[model samples]
Target: MNQGDKWTYFLGCYPLYSHDADDNRMFRIITSQLIDAGLCRQIEILNTFGVSKSSVARSLRKYRADGIEAFFQPRKTRKGGRVLTEDVLTKAQTLLDQGFTSGNVADELHVKRDTLRKAINDGRLSTKALPPEYTTKSCRTTIDAEAAKNMGTACTRPEERIVAAFGVCDGAPVRFEPCIDIPKGGVLCALPVLLMNGLLNGAERFFGTLSGYYRTFHIIILVAFMALCRIKTVEQLRGHAPGEFGKLLGLDRIPEVRCLRSKLRELGSDADIIKQWSAYLSKYWMDQDPQAAGTLYVDGHVRVYHGGLTKLPRKFVSRQRLCLRGTNDFWVNDATGRPFFVVDKTVNPGMLAVLEQDIVPRLLKDVPNQAYDKDLIADPFLSRFVMVFDREGYSPQFFKKMWKEHRISCITYHKFPDDAWPEEWFKEQKVTMPSGEVVTMQLAEMGSFIGHKKSGLWVREVRKLTNSRHQTSLVSTAYDMEYQKLASCMFSRWCQENFFGYMMHHFAIDLLAEYGTEQLPAGEEVVNPAWRQLVRERSSLQNKHRYRKVKFAELTLSEPDANDENAYNVWFSLKSSLLEELEHYEHELEGVKERIKSTPKHIAWEELSEEDQFQRLSPGRKQLMDTIRMIAYRAETAMAGLMKGPTIDTPAARRILQDLFITEADILPDTNAKILTVRVHKASRPAVNRALSLLFKRLNNSEVIYPGTDMQIFYELGGEGHPQNAGKGVTQTSPK
Candidate 1:
């Protein structure tokens, strides 16, 4: 179509190209843009207008290579066409430094305002006056607008990002700024306890650094603090004010949920790091208190998986009394139930195998002050250490092997025992429990031979006679151990179980920190699907056979009324059919048994067919989170020990400590003296205040320094002038 000297091209009445008819460059650019955007195909233009293929390709190539600007550039331009020359750049910087706004500087220097701004942002030019220092003012924001009052920086640390990009800094240093009435300042009370528990130990060596404001140390401390404060998951950070949590970390604000999740994934990338760190802490903790490690209580807690990621192997959850899809964590704890370390198993090989392969081996290395070999030889009854578990770990052969091979004595409930000894054998005696409570008990001891004759283990069989006339039997390889101590240790296995219960309720230990699955180790052995199927089928057949046999026996034992021939006939027929069915079931059961025997019970992971193979829930992040929770629990336990007086029980003491952790406190940072005084506010009750005062006083004596800072932490009970809500204690949220 033509109108005056202008012309337009139309496709199906829609204008495709419109420009002055002589403007071929404009036409080329528009058509190439349409083709690049997939709005119009090149073939359409080539066929519709009979344009040469080379001409269209050339235009499209320009659009692809140099963008639309290529269409406007002079084809043969000289190099001197640049407007921002060295002299102009120098003048621009001079104007910027002379208090000239970026727009004014750009106008004066005949440069684009964006160009001037970019130069300033890139550090090529400096503003006339520096901005005020950043003071944290807001909460729960992606960008901290309070940062240095420079809105142009997008509130994000642009300079730090640049430096990190250039590998100049690994992470932001922990720099604390002074503030009053900081929320959750009481959580800082845990810093000393966490450090003493080796929360930050081996962190630098194992994790290296995280490339952001929240470094490795920051993330580790954040997680530990979260555990202590009962922040169940990373996602839960959204519910709390990030700025308030940041005060706990000595940061402007905590990392957002997504950012924290990414950090966790990065930290958990190497599963081996979690293992090594846990091992290191185990040794460190054991070294701190050798007697506690002498008798380690081992137990397995199943963490159920309710995700759709993969079909995890089902394990019988004793607590729930149902076989649930989950992973098993076998925790080895001290006599007081303070965890040393935990071993997780996806395809569990049972308690016996785990103790033999994983737990005992680590114990051999970490359990300090073990009796020397020469000492063991001089006294055959002497043991390196004692392993106390429940009846689940009981095995005559295992007990024998532990004593014979490693001399690591084992104490567990006797899985099998002869009839209880005569009542006369029991004697009343006072047994000092691990908790230092003295209780009277009727106890007796004897030497019992267990396992096969040649390889049998001579174990001390200890029995506790209760008032109800029930005898609780216990077996121990620690032959020389006092019978009362054996009974005490045997009963102390409940501490590990209690640990599981308390952690599940208070610490959310069962919560999955991350969701995803990883391939199980190559060549790892798992239960054979085919064999399992055969065994299941065999059991079904056996059940049917037993039912039919019971019915047949009943028929044989019964006498049908002789007067009624039809009744007798019916009975005979029913009995015959039942017997025939039983015979058939027996045959099927035998066949299934044979199949089970032929099929390997366990097979390599790779040996499974593609459809049968499965991935395990990623344990790296969960294990890391579990270890953090363990540290939190141990810290609380240690503090509770300090708080538990004759008046307070363990539970009450722990409750008070939890309240103390969340109580508001004044964080006084003395930069000059390098001291961080955490003046915790007073509790509602004077008793609690006194207990907290004594607890903090004990903590103060430790001389522990805050992580990433040289400032020594000092604790005190705040005066009554502080408001009750100043540091509101965080209570563990009840599980939904």
Candidate 2:
């Protein structure tokens, strides 16, 4: 089209003439636009472009109705191909700097092999004088096993993802037949405890079955029994006679160390189910006895990872009195040392974190409102369930938040009270420990607000005054509970700590089950180590500046200008030197201020130092093993609970249980009567023997069945009234 003057126009995909295109059918459209712009008349336009006047009018009608959008084809762009990210490039460059070949760096960074080849070909990854490939060795590239395992071919199925792990394969589980005697840490004593706690039934529900002769019930029995014998590591089975433990399982041989480890790993794979099962078992415990749910003790136990070279986060190990790389596990136990459940702090978050975020919320969700006092909840206000922990959980925000949000109460020791109670406030009263032992303590009561002033409340505080003027205060939210009982609950927090100590020594509760790790979530925020270093360096520089300032003042404070020329010159030189030093210090401070501005305060886990992101193992397997150990400890505790009263104190009862658990017993199975008789050998100590007899009578009343055998277990003293050689040995008698 011409505009009456000689106009030069470059037309490709037209930018200015957007409302018209090649699909307009003729130049009539262009002619109409020309007339609309007063470049020409409608009839003159028809003549100029060699088109009809009616067509020009019609084109004008279309332009007025449809507008510019109707003339253009849809625009599009390509997406989701290769991602040439800065991170990938930086990593590749770093690898090259570290002497890795181009191919090796490409493989390491998971960049496509061809992408790296193209990068070198296009000069994106290499320069001419010192190309990335030429600067490094010509090493062959290899795929990462972990990476290969994650991504697979079209033939791979989702179900076939986990390749079966291979180790020294032990034989399948098989029974040794009847009459074969195995000491097995005398697992017979633990029979009632298992049956009482639903370990056998629980395993079936949670773990299901194994293909071998050993069922879910068999593994549960074996692990608990092994724990009783202090056989912590499965490798310990190497020293023990497998056949001896086999007899306990009604098998020809106990599953060897390999098989046992395999079983635990298998359980770990189904960690979710086992976790649910643990909850199920704990609920059963509380259901059997409602009082067990009254007030629970919560604490975190550190299990140091001594075997691995992992750079896991450090936790304070109380017993070791040092910070060590380990996992932090929070455990919940009832008043009498019975385990409720434990959750692994996979990131080693402290007890208070786990309590508020996980344990307390879970407890509140699981229990009915006013579980301790049902009537209190009927008025549309729920009664709080008490949790007794140490002073570590004594944050005002934590206490107030738990109460207001979840209606959960906490009884941690008072942190940093101003003064001890007066002597007159102390009154002698008997307080029963969680173990059922009653002790006389001088007690006092008062009230104080906890947490922040706006969100906190006035709660009862109990003080236990000692003979040496030492006083311990316990803060409680259970205002209506008896003062003595509340004091006992507060003091009973030790029972949970003791429970941790006992498990560590007996069941290897502190042992790390696996040394495998996975990458943490990318969004998890952590302090940048580089930033922290910068901060500390700044502080150090500031301290040095302060010292120099003080020194400069000290030199200048008493000196006056000397009347003598030599003295005046000396003073002037010294003052000038001091001023120069001050200037030097000020320059350093300014540089530090600039450096701090560039440093990041926090970064996502992905941006963390490589070691910090994945130095800790996943808690799945540790959790599985932990649950097994909890059941074992629970069994032992059940026996201990029954041995209470004047005859046996807690320590004495423990000794009795130890003897009973280790004693040899005769196995007698009556097919017709559906009974399995365990005639236990007596203890050397007469008092223990008496306690043993009483414990056996109680266990026999439970009439627990042998796992896998389904035969009711009956306990009896092998030597009748005589304590001589009672626990040494017993013969399996055939029932008539």
The positional error of residue 408 in candidate 2, measured at the CA in angstroms, is 1.7
Q: TM-scores, in order shown?
A: 0.77, 0.66
By summed lDDT, which 10 consecutive residues of candidate 2 come out lowest?
A: 134-143
Give the candidate number with the greatest lDDT: 1
Error of 1 at 593 (Å): 1.8
Q: TM-score of the candidate numbered 2?
A: 0.66
Clashing pairs in 2: 175-251, 175-252, 176-251, 176-252, 396-451, 681-726, 681-727, 682-726, 682-727
RMSD of each: 21.8, 36.4
What is the per-residue lDDT of model 1 for residues 390-497, given as tens digits with 9 covering 90 to 100? 888988888888888999899988878889899999999998888888889999989888777876778889998999999999989987788889988988778888
lDDT of each residue in 1-736, candidate 2, tens digit only: 3344322222454533432234344344454555576655776656654667677787777666775443453534322235556667667766656434566666677777777766666655662243332211111111122223554211122232222122222323322233423354356788667666666655655676664444566676777777777778777788865544566676544565776777777777755787788788777776776667768788888777865646666678888899887767788888877788887754655578788778876777565334454455563334467888898888777776776665677787889675776799899999887665789999999888776668677777889898888998888776667889988888777777778778887788777676577655557665677887888888988888788788778778856667777877877788788788889878988987898899887777778766556455766677766776777777777787788777676777777777667777656555555666666766677777777778778876665555444456677665432212122211121111
lDDT of 2 at 298: 85
* Backbone clash numbers for all candidates listed: 1, 9
